[model samples]
Target: MKKIAIFENQYHQVKIQFEVANKIFFNDMLEYHQFNSSQDYTPISNISEFNLVIIDISLSSNSDKDGFDLIEEILIQNNPPKILILTGNSNIKENLKKRNLPDLPILMKPIDPIDIKDNLSKLLV
Candidate 1:
């Protein structure tokens, strides 16, 4: 099974919804790991263990880094996993541009299960 890691701090409901939807649709093929902050995820020595990573732009104050920082760290790996951005921030495009990151797939806030599934399908392909 492929693994997916999620880094989300503020949107528990959205995360729960995605988990349910994933279980219903891709349970046999995908496994999900959720982290509430950078602190929770930073301990993992192998970021490439996951097939994909979903990140929320805004993180809790307790986190040592934000989503962008996490993305940069992941991208520097020899075999970086695919990334999907989930955010409410309107300036996400500008942020990516400012950081010189690629135009990754993005899911805006207030998304439904269908939206998540669609993006997952694309990323997992």
Candidate 2:
């Protein structure tokens, strides 16, 4: 079983992500956690416990950095978990491209349930 950490500020988005994953994964098969702030993300800095960490670009209170700061924090870990960046906006697509974060996968939001299931299944396998 793999552990998953969902880092997002919005309740609806977090719920949506959880529902998508739950539909595909049984409860006993996975471990999950969530954080709504950079402050909240402190306890779970070590990525070894999670196989994947999903981050939402738009945070409710922390809207200044466009989530790049969270990305940077995750990168500081000794063995960072695989990252999946979720965003509804395409404006930052080029910006992220410039950064060249090869290990991260950017998933556009209004996320498709099928895409999440399929990609996660692939990761677990």
Best by TM-score: 1
The TM-scores, one per candidate, come to: 0.90, 0.78
Model 2: residues >4 Å from true position, as ranges?
Answer: 14-17, 25-28, 43-45, 63-66
Worst 10 residues of 2 by lDDT: 59-68
Whole-model Cα lDDT per candidate? 0.85, 0.69
lDDT of candidate 1 at residue 11, scale 0 to 100: 58
Local accuracy of candidate 1 as per-residue lDDT tens digits, 59-103:
788878889988888888888999999998889999999999988
Per-residue lDDT of candidate 2, residues 1-125 (tens digit) = 67888777775654766675665665547666777765665554566678888778776576444476777777888888888877787766676667765546676777766767766776666
- Model 1, residue 107: distance off in Å is 1.0
Write out the backbone clash pairs for model 1.
none
lDDT, candidate 2, residue 52? 87
